[model samples]
Target chain A: MIERLKDLWAHRELLWNMTVKELKVKYKRSVLGFAWSFMTPLVMLLVFSIVFSILARGGDVQWYAVFLMSGLLPWLFFVNSLMQSVGSIVANPGLVKKVYFPREILPIAAVGANIFHFVLQMLVFFVFMLLIRWHFSPWLLLMPFILILQVVLTLGLALLVSAANVYLRDVQHFVEVALTALFWLSPIVYPVGLVASQFPKFMPLYLVNPMTNIVLLWEYAIYNPHHYGPQVAYISFWGILITVVFSIVTLVGGYYVFARIERGFAEQI
Target chain B: MEHAVEVREVSKMFKLYHENVRSLKEKVLFFRKRGYEEFWALRDIDLDVEKGETLGIIGANGSGKSTLLKCMTRIIYPTSGKIMTDGSIAALLELGAGFQPDLTGRENVYLNASILGFSRKEVDGKFDEIVAFAELERFIDNYVRNYSSGMYIRLGFAVAISVDPEILIVDEVLAVGDEAFQRKCLDKIDEFRDSGKTIIFVTHNVDVTREICDRVIMLEEGRIVRDGIPKEVVNHYHQVMETEEEASEQGNRKIEITEVRLLNDRGEETNDFYTGSSMKVRVCYEAREPIVDPVFGFSLDDYRGFTAFGTNTALKGLEMGTVAGDGVVEFDLKSLPMLEGRYLVSVAAHSRDEQTVYHWQDKLYQFEMKSDIDDVGLLYIPCEVKTGPQAG
Candidate 1:
């Protein structure tokens, strides 16, 4: 695995070029260009805040728009990265068959392109927090660490699905359906307290999902944890620890599966 | 001699599944083992290529020539054994294989060069030379999707040749481009050869193998059948192909042409004759049952597949009497008025009264004609020189 990282490092220029090409091609002829990236999550935030704040009355959380935006941006990044990376190998059959390079570069480049959009959306979230007169906390500095963990987890899944999709095209559809289910299962649209109160026994199983911890960490960074009571602060610490372990395991497992099937990709694709 | 490439007992096998389950429902519903067959594309192949030697591989379709090339370049790994190469290798398997149509020619050149393992600085250094070689100076900024097919091929060839690798693998990529560009590309290859670069060329064009390759390997049915000097190997490949064709044709025989012989004017069987000499083609056939009015004919073609002359008994208003078991029909040419070159003879028997062709053999027999006088073009017609003052 170290050797593979070294190989990828040697081809860093190729990875960078491919990522830039993806970004350029995505918004090549459009007049709105990069604005679409911010527009998508913001528009989703608007619709969710309207529905949840008016209908459900936010339950007990305040500043619901800020809570929704913080989680929605990261979720969009994860889902978009997986969707693009899953088809990356099969989509470039011409390159896959003709050239010799680290096959993982395709998926890694897809994740890198989406990371650009993720960072942009985070900036928008920061601006919204300031407008809502949210307090500044030194915990915001730790947000990068959490973001890195999320990226690692996403990269692992992307590698596995991209390589597998070369052999089984149904992987793309499976991922689409799986992402929808995962979105509702995680605490993206509603608060984590609602799930804990409704099913206290099932909360342990629900916390095992890496996205659950990731979304809570984003909330911890954006919203002051003191306002959420003692129970919320205690869960955030354990959630961060579980997310770290889960990210490492997923990344390692995904890399192993990707390496095993990559040798046959030229023939299968 | 120092070797540039070495292969020992290498083989590749591909599994052919009875049914490829592309969807989850198909996999879940089918609760039995999926049947499959294994196909061996290369079997325990062993060979060595010395440094600077242009080795040519020739074979019929599906004879594993491209598979061996791909294996050598590591595009696909072998199922067993080992292969080793000494230097940086570049392969041109298919022209324009990675060019994105939406990008401009300038952008694509950089992108394609990088994919071929050139660094950004290296491409920057060679960018001008690549564009000049491709002759796309004025249109370099235009998207490749708008470029003509010829322009696209030129650009692809230019970018491929610009990268100077220690070893090059070319698989019939020169089959495209116009005559001038093809010649230029071949010239560049020759220059590379002079610089002591190892080249592996795979082509079906015998003339190219004879012209450029010092050594040749002939593959058939996933095994090496012949390997030696270009002349002998090419001859063996042609003979093997002819025998295979005859064996396959024999399986579906109604009125089979058992033997075809070329006889001289003195009734001596020979494939070598002088230009303008009378030659006869004797086609001996066997009939499984009695048949009537079967047209017998033969065509004479030059080495380039240009037909010099063709005539049948029906076209000449000649009739052959019916035969039951075995008989021979002979075509006697008054003069073989063709230039000094190797020519192929094809024979056919038709029952179509021009409708059904019972048996047809293409380029089945080859003959050589010699001439003392120097001449050009496909045919040499006898003419009387009458150089005199113009008549008013």
Candidate 2:
């Protein structure tokens, strides 16, 4: 592990350049290139706000539009990173078969590119919140900490899927179906409180889902339902510990599986 | 002496899959079936390249030459054993292996340099030199997708060579681009040799290996068959390849070789000749059926399978039209300029274009030449020495 880390460090510039390449290629030859990054979340925000307003017929939650944006933006970051990274290795067989620096660079660069887009979208969304004169809790300072957790978790899963995709291409298609199911399972469209209250008997089982815990932390930090909606339990001490432990475990385990299988990658491809 | 690269008991095995089983359904369907054949690409290969030495690897196709190179470069791991290198390595397994099409040439230069583990600061120092070397100064700012194939390859070669790695592993990349660029790359490699860095090169171009390599290894199948000085190992390679080729004889048999003989100036059949002496090659053929416009030719080749001389009656404007029975054709040579060596002769009878071979005996006849003249080379040249002062 130390040797691998040293090699990764020595080739840090390569990692940086590859990440930049991914970001640049994603935006090239399009008139409204980088703008497309935020458009997905904003469009989803618009459609969901209107649709949920009609479905609830006067929901009691205050500043619900801002509430959805906070959870939805970070959700896009996690989801898009996984989607792009799953096929990263198989897409660039030229780099994998012909050159050797660190094989992990391919998937890591894909995640890195999504990270840039995610940050850009978040900055724009946060500035728009300030312009709306919306009040944010002091807990919003933990947004970066929550983001780091999400990144580690996403990168871990990304590494696992990308390496598995090289051996069994069905893994990429499988990831698409799995992400759709996972999206609804997470509290992106609704609050964790609704799930906790509706299925009070299974609330522990629901918290076991890492994203449920993670999205609740995002709500706790940026949404801060304690300030907006008094009935909601936005902050949970157990949720923070679970999110932190789950993120680290996934990262370490995902990277371990990825490294073990990568030796067969050139031949498999 | 310090070794730059050491490969110890390294062997690589690859599974040749009968059917690709990527999907879950296919994997389940083939779960009980044997799905692949095990093929060993390299076998217990042990070699150490001394620092500052230029080593050459030569082999036929599918002989694991490229596999060994990929192993040394860490592009693929060996199935057994390990390869350790003392210094940083830059491998040109394929020119422009990772150049992104959307990126500009300047961006790709730094990008490709980074892929080979060179720092941006290092690339910054040699960036202009790379563009100049590739002759892409005008297209450096343009996207690589728009560059011509030759231009793209040139830029790849330029960036790879400019890295100036401690241990350079090159595989057939020198054969790329036009002749002039090849010459320049070779010259630059020669300069690298002078600077005392290690180089491991794999190429089918034996002549170039003879010129540049301090040591050469020849691979056959998955094993190294010969390793020595370049000249000796290359000769062994020629011998191995020539002997591997089966001697074949196929023809319509309208006119087939019944007998062949080599005679001296006095018209006596012999298998020995002296340099500068007259000789005759006689081919006797029996025509089982009437054949028209038949040509016969013979080539004298050294033991290394290099053809030294060859000619045919078709080229000499001699045509045998509709021959019926046995006949003799004599190739009369006034003098032989061959130096001292054992030579083999291949005689053939065919149509005018030599396409429809009536019969071909590939290196089936042998002879020896003796030369007392003080000279060295494939041919014995007549000379007269003159001693003179520095006056006009």
TM-score, every prediction: 0.79, 0.84
**Candidate 2 chain B: 10-residue stretch with minimal lDDT:** B239-248
DockQ of each two-chain model? 0.44, 0.71
Candidate No. with top TM-score: 2
Off by over 4 Å in 1: A131-133, A227-238, B31-33, B239-392
Q: Candidate 2: where are CA atoms >4 Å away?
A: A231-234, B238-246, B250-300, B303-360, B364-376, B379-392
Interface quality of candidate 2 as DockQ? 0.71
**CAPRI-style class, candidate 1:** acceptable
Task: Report the C-alpha displacement of residue A195, candidate 2, in angstroms.
Answer: 1.5
Q: Among all windows of ten consecutive residues in candidate 2 chain A, which has the lowest summed lDDT? A: A230-239
lDDT by residue (B121-186, candidate 1, tens digit) is 988898999999899999999989899999999999899899989899999988988999999999
